[model samples]
Target: MPTTTQLVISGQSKPGVMAQVASVLASAGVNIKAFSAPEVTGTGKLRLLVADLEGARAALRGAKIRFAEETALVLSLENKPGALNEVADLLTQARINIKCGYCTPSREGKRAIVVLTVSNTEKALSVLRDQSLDEF
Candidate 1:
């Protein structure tokens, strides 16, 4: 049940905006472990899991980039179909709602690290831990 802080950035969608944001993080020496940015209509949002949280915050502040922060659960699941479905079912049974989530292949390619922002952090952690989903 490892928890990490995710930076959320929202603004109008424009060419080079993501590049600018990336530059800011890079300049601040914040390593981006994962990210999800999607554009809809004329706006977009960027969610980033950065290694250096404080550095990322400072950089965003210095760049006048308004952002929000949220706690995210990081889980490593087997790289197979229905892996996420199983986790989702567990959370659903616990009456927890998933706000957003994304997955990326692990370095070894044998597993996937799923980052999830759920409605109930404590409950989600407890449920996952109780189910031995944290073995990874």
Candidate 2:
């Protein structure tokens, strides 16, 4: 099963803030698993997936950065065409609305890891799990 890990970078509300943050991660060779910017003002939030979450967090803090954290659902599905359509169909049928989602392929497989940010997390998890096709 895949697990979603959220890294909350201090708000980068100002333009160019995200670039600075991304530069730091890029310099560290951290692969971004998933990314999101909160709509809050002043402080910006960035959620990332790195090869090493602890190490990344430590590095950021060593640089005197602030961040928050959370666990999300990360699932991998077939990369073939229409794969997403199937998932969407299922969710729609279940009356689940996906607020946001991002996808990236695994380095070693023909599967894409999708991080879904939804309102009804627990219910979504249940539905996905019941389908025997998702891992969170």
Candidate 3:
């Protein structure tokens, strides 16, 4: 299985927080591939997969943004019923907890990419890689 580093940013939620972060990355010529931002109770969290990890890190550091980088499993699964459930079950059976996850919208006759942050990245990757999913 292949794994990629994902940046997780958490801070007090406020207007323009995401904009500022993106601006910093963009100024550094970093391209964001996948992103998710969810805010609750004045706190916000952002997760992103960047085309240039080093550049993004530098930009974040230059902007004084605190973030954590972790290994994430990216799976390309068939766009069909029970696809996600199968992955979830595989993780559950291994006692691996999913810390955070999101999937791209599935299109007809196409596969969907699911990005998962698991409690045990190596184990999850091993398990998923062993499966017959479209790709891991």
Q: Whose TM-score is greatest here? A: 1
Residue pairs with backbone atoms closer than 3 Å in model 3 (clashes) = none
lDDT of each: 0.92, 0.73, 0.87
lDDT of 2 by residue, 1-136 (tens): 4556677676648888777777777777676656877677766567777777877787777666788776666878887899888877877888888876778888887888887766666777777778887543
Q: Tell me, by lDDT, which candidate is best.
A: 1
| Candidate 3 lDDT tens digits, 12-97 | 88888889999999999999999978658777779999999999999999999999988988888878899899999999999999
13-102 in candidate 1: lDDT tens per residue?
Answer: 888878999999999988998999865778788899998898999999999999999999999999999999999999999999999999
Task: Indicate whether candidate 1 or candidate 2 has the larger TM-score.
Answer: 1
Name the regions of candidate 3 deviating beyond 4 angstroms: 106-109
lDDT for position 75 in model 3: 85
Question: Model 2: residues >4 Å from true position, as ranges?
Answer: 13-15, 26-31, 34-45
Query: Candidate 2 lDDT (Cα, whole model)?
Result: 0.73
What is the C-alpha local distance difference test score of candidate 1? 0.92
